[model samples]
Structures are given as structure tokens and as C-alpha cells.
Target: MRIVEDLRAELGDRIVTEPQVLQAMRTDRSGWVGPGTPAVLVRAASVADVQAVMRLASVHRVPVVPRGAGTGLAGGAIGTEGAIVLDLSGMRRVLEVDVQNEVAVVEPGIVTDDLAAVLAEHELWWPPDPASRAISTVGGNIATNAGGLLCAKYGVTRESVLGLRVVLADGTLIGVGRRTVKGVAGYDLTALMVGSEGTLGVVVEATLKLRRISRDPVVTIGATFPDVIAAAAAAAAITASGLRPAALELMDAATCTAIDDLLQPSAEYPVLAGRGAFLLVRTDSAAAADEAALAARLIRHAGGEPEVSTDALTGERLMQVRRSAHPAYARLGEVLIEDVAVPRSALPAMFAATERIGASHGIPIPTIAHAGDGNLHPNLVVPPHLAGEPGHIPDVVWSAADELFHEAIALGGTLTGEHGVGILKRRWLADELGGDVFALSERLKAAFDPLNILNPGKVL
Candidate 1:
């Protein structure tokens, strides 16, 4: 397209049209499958630059795929065949911090953790922290309406957003939502942008609500069981007890082994080799008696051995091990990460079905979960050497996971809880949402992007 020629001249050598550049940006952390090359890559600096690119794409009838740090696990930032990748990573900035109002306005490329660090200096906190917070951008989180460990109490990204500045497909910039505590706003476009997955418009900036930073003492609880089903049962029971914990996580035997190898833990029994899966639950309070007693009762009822920890450093160390799961699994093989979620009661069945799927396919699928919120991550380890063949173990494991994905939908659950449905889950989206719902979503997409030049073939 001649638009590529215009972008090259406008953005100078920063605009990359080379084959290798296209290849690198076309895939994300999910690694579901490689994607087709984008015709051009425009690394935008200022909002004006973004406006220029959007205007050109609109005029030329070219697709524009908006991208942040490329840390997305669901391929949300991936480009389509012969499209323009509007890379927003260069626009990182803290535009404004209204400390009095308890809000911060930032550009889309600002990392979640970085924003948290800045907020920490002011004794403030932004609570929507996904696992990839250190690398993922605020815009990506807004697109997916991400949920995280604290979601059981704090809610997801949707509840935190107060205002948004979105650039529509036709290059119209509209501000939505109010900065004040509450308002009966018009259609609530700010709410609509959350979890839209870039199909509607580009999120240029956001004003997010903040909470007071706390230094409360934390109590950690560790519970082990012979299988994932028992642990899931314990998780559900703990939530049912009404004692909300800071974090409720589960790690399978394989994952524990991976963590042990990576951190070289000196525990008497390796974290994984304790004979089964374990639950790591944390509460951000010094009053551990209530939380600890509830956890113990639930764990025992679910057929688990429970241990409550009051030591801060020891609990922190164990939480570190839990957070290291993804990187450790990456070292073992090519990772096929599934972010499927089911009802709280359906978790035990989901775990059982996952184990059966692995065994049936002769593939070992180690699992983990943010159990408090019923978000399950079943990582399928694919050995690099065996990649690309139809008979590869990774491919087999992925097929099994696909079956589980459909099963979750059948049980009135979603294919993804936190991770957005990028190209990886595009085919099954209709199956989950159905024909009429899908058509309504498409009509909304058309209303916002009449030219159909924004992140084509992603969620529709």
C-alpha cells in the first residue's frame, strides 16, 4: 500500500517494513502459532503520531493493529497479513498524577509495575496486577479488563478505571468517564472499552482509581493434598468461609519441581515432592487466628494437611516460589499457556478432566491456579526440538487443552478469565458467545470501526 511509503517518510527509519521486523511483532507470549506478517510497523512516539498513522490507515483502508509491550499471552497485539502494527511502547509517560483525587493518568505503554512503583513513592497503590505486571502495559490490561490475585476482594481492571481517552477507528479522540468518585454518565464508553480487546478502538490514556498503600503484616498458609481436585475443593471451601485472603494460589507437583530447580530451595522436602499439589494462601493482616482457623478447617475437610505461617520472611520466600512458576515452566519446554476458567464448584471437575486429558494423550500437563477467583492455568510443556510436526507432544497436549476449553464453555464458563482472546482463541469465540451474541458484537465493532481497519481477525 502507498500508505507504507507515506509512513516511512513521516516516521523516518523508525518505520520498519523488513521481513524480520514483521516476524518478531506478529507473535506474543502465548506462542499459539506464528502469524502472517504485517505490511508495515509504525513505532509511534506521541499521541499526535498515533493520530497521523490512524488517519492515514483510515484513508487508505488499511488495517492498524495497536500494540504495547508485546507481553500479551493471548496474542492480542499480533498483526494480521498486510497490516500496520501501531507500536505504542514508545509513548510511555506519566501524564498526570492527581494525588488529591487519588488517581493517575498515564499513556498506554506504561508498565503496571512501574506505575505501582511511582505510586508507592506517594503512599498509593494500583491493585489490578496480572502476573505479567512487570512487563505488560496498562493499555493491554484495559483491553483485556484483567483480573489478578487480589480480584477476590479488589475486583478487576473494570472496577478501577474512572476515566479513559480513546482514539476511535476514524481518528476521533473522545474522552469518557468522570474523574470524580461517582457519576451517572451517558453510555459509559469507559466501561465498554474495558475487555474490548482492541477491536473497538485504541486506548490512548486512562485515569485509574488508586488505593491507600498499606504495610500490614501478612500471614501465609500452606496446604497440601494428594491431587489437584482436593486442593481445588479446599480453595472453594476457603472462599465459601468468607475470609478473603490476599492471594490464593495452587501449584502442581511438576510446577513445584520446576520452582525447586530454579530457586535451589533448601526446604526439608522439595516444594513439589511433598507427595502432591499444594495451596499457597496469604492474608494481609496480623490477625491470623480467624483466617488461619478457617483455612485449617477447610483444608482438612477437603482432605488436605494444613500449615499456617505467621513469619513474614518465610511466607514471602514461599510466595516468591509461587510467582516463579511461569519462568520455570518456560525452561522445561515450549509453553502452551491456557487461561480457561470455570465456576467455583466446577473447578474440581475441571481439574479432574484436565488430568484425564493429559493421561489420555500421553502428555503430562502440570497445572496451577489463582483458585480464589477460579482462574486456571494449565501449562502444556512443548519441547522445542519436537515443534512443527503433527505428531509432536506439544501439539497433542494443545489438542487436549482445546477439548478442555470447549468443556469449560459447556459448563457456562469462559475460554479466558484474564488473558484476552487474541488470535489463539479467535475460532472458538463464536462457540462460546454463540451466533446472535457474536453478530451483536460484530455490529458494535462496525459502529466503532466502520472501515474495519483495526486489529482485523482478532475477536470477531
Candidate 2:
């Protein structure tokens, strides 16, 4: 199409059409989805540039995939055939920080942790911190309503957003929500777009509500269990106890071993004992006595052995271990990550079911979880060679994943908790939303994007 020529002339070197460059942008953190080459990528530096790209795509009836840092796990950023990649990584600006009002206005490309750091200077914070916060963009977080360690207490990214600047499929720019804390404005379109996964509109800017930054010392607790069921039981008990922690994470034996090898190659299990599956608990407290007592009591009640660390630096370092749990497994082999969630009450059963599925498939499925939120990521590692081989391994991996996801649905849960139904989970969406409900969703998609050009093949 000559439109590529137009974009290249208008965007100069900012537009990339080379095969290698386009190929590089085709995958994400997990690298498990589309390998479709985009016709071109427009590296938008300003709102006007984004508008230009959108205007062209709208007129040409070309699909445009809004992209941020491309850190999505569910292939939300992957492009389809002959599409335009509206790259926003160049618009990384913090527009406004209203400390008194507890809000910040930022462009789509602002990195999550960087925004958090900027807010921290003014004594404010954004709590939805995905593990990739260091690299993921605000736009990606908004698209997925991304959740993380603090979601159990502070909620997800959607809760922090007060407003959005979205570009419609027809190239119209509309602002939704407000800077003020409360507004009954039109329909609640702001919330609708928050987790739309780029299916409805392309988010350009957002007004985010922040909380007062805390200097309260962190308290760390570690509890070890014999198996995943016991580990899940401890997690449930902790939640039932009514104590809100800054972070609650679970790691299985394989992941723990991987982490131990990287951090302390010479140390044995005694150094990092409580090994089968463990929970890392964190809290903000000023006194050691209270945090210590709470940890000890909960661990004993849940049939666990407790290890507590109240030193600030030490506690932070321990949390790093929890944050790196998934990546640690990636070092071992090719991974198919599963973000399966279930009702809090079904956590033990879910954990038991996962173990059973893994054994039945003969695949070593290691797990990590934001347990307090009932979100588990059970990763099935495949040696690249084995994945390519024709055998029960690939069949087994897919079967185990299907069983786990179906079980989550049967237990009154959704297919995914944080990751959107990007191409991977599209078929099962009807199973969760029902036929009529999913039909209505498709109608809504048609209503907003009649041409169906916005992130085609994503989320119905």
C-alpha cells in the first residue's frame, strides 16, 4: 500500500518497515503468540503523530495495534497481517503531578516504576505494580487492568485511574472520566476502556489517583509447607486473619531451587529451607513486636514454620526473590505460562488439581502465585528440542492447561485474572461469558469499531 510510503515520508526514520525491526516487535515478554509482520510501525512522539497514524488507518480500513513497551504476557501487542503498529514508546512523558489532589497525568509510554518513582518524590504512590513494572508502560497496564503484589489490598490499575484520553476507531479523540475523585458523568465508559485490551480504543493519556507514600519499615515473613495444598491452606488462613500485607507471594520447589542456584549457588536447603512451597509475606509496620507476633501466630495456626526479617534493606531484598520467581523458571527452559485463578475458597482444591494435572501429563509444572488474590501462574517448561518433538509432551502440556482453565471456570472463576483473552484464550471466552453475553460483547465491539480494525483478533 502507498500508505506505507506516506507514513514513512511523514514520520521519517521513526517509521520502521524493515523485516528485522518489524520481527523484533512481533513478540513480547513470554514470546508465545503471533509472529505476523506489520506493514509498518509508526513510532509516535506526540498526540498529533498518533492522531495522524489513526486518521490514515481509519481511512484506509487498516488495523492498528496500539503498542507501549510490549511487555504484555497475553500477546495483546502482537500484530496481524498488514496492520499498522501505533508505537507510543516515544511519548514517555509525565505531564502533570497533582500531589495536593493525589493524581498524576501521564502519557501512555510512561514506565510504571518510573511513574511510581516520580510520584514518590511528591510522597505519592501507584499501587498496581506488575512484576514487569520496571519495563511495562502505563498504557499496557491500563489495557490489561494489570494487578500485582499489592492488589490484594490496594486493588488493580483500574481503581487508580480517574480519567483517560482515548482515540476512537474513527480517529476521534474523546476524553472520559475526570480529574476529581468523584463524577457521575455519562455512561461509565472510563471503566469499560480500562480493561478493554485495546479492543475498544487506543489510550493516549491517563489521570491516575495516588496514595500517600509510606516510609513505614517493611516486615518480612516466610512460611514453609510440605506441599502446594498446605501452602495454599496457609495463604487462605492468612487472608482469613484480616491482616493486610503489602505483598503475599507463593513459590514452588522447582522455582525456589532455581532461585537458590542463582543467588546462593553454594548454599544447601537448610539455608533456604521450608522448600516444597513457600509464601513470602510483607507488611508495613513501625514496631518489630507487632509484626513478629503476627507472623508467628499465623504461621503456627497454618501449620508452618516461620522466618521473619524486619530490617528494611533485608526485607526489600527478600521481596526481590519473590518478584523474580517466574523469570527464574524461564532460565531453565521454554515456558508456557498459565495465569489461572479461582475463588478464594477453592484455592486448596485448585492447587491439588494443578499437582494432579502435572503428574498426569508427566510435565514438571512449577508454580508461583499472588496467592492473596487467588491468582496463580503455573508455568510448564518445555525444552525447545522437546517442544519441537512429536510426542505426548506437547499434547500433555496443552491438555493440562485446558483442564486447569476449565476447572477454574467450573469453580466460579474466570479464564484469566490479569492477562486478557488475547488470542490464546479467545475460544474459552464464550464458555465464561455465555453465548448471549459474548454475542453482546461482539455487538459492542462492532458498535465502537464498525470496521473491526482496532487490535483485531483480541478479546472478541
TM-score for candidate 1: 0.94
Q: What TM-score does model 2 achieve against the real structure?
A: 0.95
Taking the tens digit of each residue's C-alpha lDDT, what string does model 2 give over 303-350?
778788777766777777777776677787777777888877678888
Each model's TM-score, in the order given?
0.94, 0.95
Name the lDDT value of residue 47 in candidate 1.
Answer: 75
lDDT, each prediction: 0.83, 0.82
CA RMSD for every model? Answer: 2.3, 2.5
Q: In model 2, what is the error at residue 2, expressed in angstroms?
A: 2.0
